[model samples]
Target: MKFSRQILSSSFSLDKVPGWTCPWCDKSAVSGKKDDFRIIESVQSKSQHSHPEWEPFRITGTFCGTLICSDENCGEQVVVSGLMEVEERGWCDEGEYFSSYEEILTPLFFVPAIKLFNIGNNIPIAIKDAILETFSAFWQDLSTAGNKIRKVCELIMNDKKIVKTYIDKNGKRKEYSLHTRIDFFGKLKKGEREQKAYGLLMAIKWIGNSSSHVNNSLTKADIINGLEMLHHILELLYDKDYMRIYKLGREYNKKKGPLKHPLFGTRHL
Candidate 1:
């Protein structure tokens, strides 16, 4: 399933809102519990309240709240916590401009973990675990989440039986880098699908590399882009139904029409 970029990037106000995908059902959106948000101002921020130069932007605090799945059949509850900050908002009314400050809640953690995208049962257990871990790290640390994504590349290589170690001319075993293994896998099968998979993996690899370095500027959006590519890769490699449909399409195009079965007559177009 495709992810909702708006939901992932949104910051909440006081009112109950719906956007997050439900981790349990995977078919519903979760909304914040009504008037459930609680904010606790930091001591430093509170101390500045008495200052004449104090402004709403100077406010800083922590917030916690509850979110409930919108689907009544799958009304799962999730707890969320994050930093609270003041945001300046302006609007035009009757050709006049008015500015105001309001509290903004930026989520950093969610209990039971939210699903960023659908993970098929066909996926390997190790890869699934790594992806879940990446989801956990996504809110707290983008870089760590990126590193986890890089680990997924290694796991994919292992599953594909790509050579990881080989005997060198000196009779010593040498390990291959992730890039080399991926390149080898790409070359193992020469086809449009293989080339597409290689390109997607390479993009993910580059993002992962950027995340590993401290000097590199990594954003949540960047990680999300990698996740989207990884989702497509998993579908391309492991989704049996997807592969069957793709094969049928290729056959149809090759014959310029539907194929006929000897016993069943013409196959359905």
Candidate 2:
């Protein structure tokens, strides 16, 4: 996404403005004031699926608003900008998130809905880059998990398949086909729902939904919690000990960390 204007209009006094409000704290502070204020805006794209084989794309939209206090203590600000949905169907130059379905699907509602969608007020050096980085990292990790599962599936399928061969009777010789009456693997393996590999892959879908949609469904805390859950689940799937969790837990235990989980105890990486 891109922005057309940096300084929207010379910051007008709060009294002069009618319905302007801060996006951060959602406080109705005095708008009209003699301060170095300007309305800045930005545009960017968002993606849904993190299919390893599929490419990703960028979205462009504007986030316009005024910067109120520069001090960290009184850090509050108001912004108003035009933002479009993360086109679900169109093709994008930056990535491959855009799809055919977006064309028919209604454009995302940008107003009150966007306000709830944390657009981090910190205003980093590169907004688009930051969003992309978050999305790309998640996609890459999911891709890795997906690849591993696919390989496992292929191995299971091939191992159970029956192969057959035949020969022509050029010299009065003939051949017969080899066929398996039943699936030996099926009898040996448990149900699909009980398999750890299947569960791990399904969890990836849940993460994708939470991150892509602008339904204001998942909170910051929720995402973090989900990530922690996914990490542990993946560890269990791999039939491996969670070294990272253990190491981090040990560090936190010594420091008397504030937050605590049953297994981790507190310190987390």
Candidate with the greatest lDDT versus the true structure: 1
Q: What is the lDDT of residue 63 in candidate 1?
A: 93
lDDT tens digits, residue span 1-269, model 1: 57566767778788646567889998888777558778889999999999999988899999998888989999999999999999888999999999998888889999989988889989999999999998888889989989999899889889988889989999999998888889998999576666788889988889889987979898888988888888889988888777767777777888887677322225532
Question: Each candidate's TM vs. the true structure?
Answer: 0.90, 0.21
Which candidate number has the best TM-score?
A: 1
lDDT for 129 in candidate 2 is 33
Candidate 1 regions exceeding 4 Å error are 94-96, 262-269
By summed lDDT, the worst window of 10 consecutive residues in model 1 runs over 260-269
* Candidate 2: tens digits of C-alpha lDDT, residues 135-198: 2232124333233333332332344342222356565444321112113333444544224434
Poorly placed runs, candidate 2 (over 4 Å): 1-204, 239-269
Candidate 1 collision pairs: none
C-alpha lDDT of all candidate models, in order? 0.85, 0.35
For the record, the alpha-carbon RMSD of candidate 1 to the native fold, in angstroms, is 2.8
